[model samples]
Target: MFLRKIANAIGGLLFLALFLTFLVQITARFGFNQPLPWSDELAVILYLWVILWACAFVVPEKEHVMFDLVWNSVSPTTRRLMRLVGHTLIGGLAIAAIPASWSYVHFMAREKTAVLGLSFEWVFLPFVLLLLSLAARSWHGLVQAMNNRDLDIHEANP
Candidate 1:
């Protein structure tokens, strides 16, 4: 529980910082006549981090998009079975994606962003985190499906 709290706190801080920086950039660009060159890329990358981290942070809350009307109408057993299939497919995709994204990031490391001179890894790191988080979340969903009793698709608090 404590660890979950810490993760939540860090996620919140990261999101807050991302938005604050974007606001600052917008203000500088419009409120004043001067705009920082790195603001656009930095804001986009920061938004990526928020979305990636939010995957782990949000799924436990059952907040991701779902076809709830359809899901609710299905028989419980069928729902569980479908859940396993869906989660398995998603997890497998996540596992497969890590290597390909990593390779692209590595290949681009020699080049720098036009504005920030940032390594491509800076952009790709969020994708790695996103995929890993999906893998973890989907695995948890699979475990719950296998249990086949009182299943909750939320990721474990850990």
Candidate 2:
């Protein structure tokens, strides 16, 4: 619950920042006829953070896009098997990519954004968080499958 609150707060704050930055950009460009150099870049950065953060923390698993035709048709035991296989593949791939993702993000530290001069490493760090979240969620799903806690297709969809 605490973590959920934190995630919601972060997601809200990022969106607010992005919206404010956009307003500032528009006001400066059209109202004052003097555009700020950093506003666009800042907006882009905030947009990226907002999207990736939502994907990683804010969005519920059931809300994600899924092709559930087969899933809906399968029996509970078959669904469990599917969940196990799917989560295992997803979690395994995410875990495998973490090291390389970390290396690339670390290497980007030397590069900075054009206007903000903020390290690229900081900008791209959310990607690592996303990968970690994916793996964690997959693990959770795997565990649920093992425990025979599969959600009905109707429940998941509706």
Candidate 3:
């Protein structure tokens, strides 16, 4: 629940910032005789942040697009097995991504944004957070599956 709130708040704020920046840029460029050069760069960064953080919300919400036709048609035992396999795979992938993303962040830690002059590592921080959240969700799913709980075809909260 706390994670959901944080994810939503961060995503919402980033999207709002991006929208306001774009509006301001448009007003400056057209209404006034000047433009905000940093607006575009800021928007890009905000867009990245919005996407990365929103994944954490989506994973637990089961909001991501999935082919649920087969899932819905499966028998109980098959469904349980599928859930176990799916959760394991997701957990493994998230675990794998952490070190890879960490290394990449470190490799580009010295690099800065062209306009904001912020470290690239800072920009990439949300990717790590996204992976960690997904990993937690995956673990939750795995535990649920092991306990003989029926996985939802479309929705679950971790």
Q: TM-score winner among the candidates?
A: 2
Q: Rank the candidates by lDDT, best first.
A: 2, 3, 1
The alpha-carbon RMSD values of the candidates against the true structure, listed in the order shown, are: 2.9, 1.7, 2.2
Q: Which ten residues in a row have the lowest lDDT in candidate 2?
A: 149-158
- lDDT at 18 for candidate 1? 88
Sorted on TM-score, best first, the list reads: 2, 3, 1
Q: Higher-TM-score candidate among 1 and 3? A: 3
What would the per-residue lDDT of candidate 2 be over residues 77-138, giving only the tens digit for each residue?
88889989999998999999999999999999999999899999999999999999999999
Q: Evaluate model 2: give its TM-score.
A: 0.94
Which candidate, 1 or 2, has the higher lDDT?
2
For candidate 3, lDDT tens digit of each residue in 46-85?
A: 8888888777664444667788888888887889999899
Winner on TM-score between 1 and 2 is: 2
lDDT of 1 by residue, 23-136 (tens): 889899999978987787888888877877777654453767766676677788888988889889999999998899878878888888888888887776777877888888
Residue clash pairs of candidate 2: none
Q: Where is model 1 more than 4 Å wrong at Cα?
A: 58-61, 150-158
Candidate 3 ranges with C-alpha deviation above 4 Å: 155-158
Error of 3 at 85 (Å): 0.8
**Cα error of candidate 3 at position 130, Å:** 1.0
**lDDT score of residue 49 within candidate 1:** 76
lDDT of 2 at 31: 100
Give each model a TM-score: 0.85, 0.94, 0.89
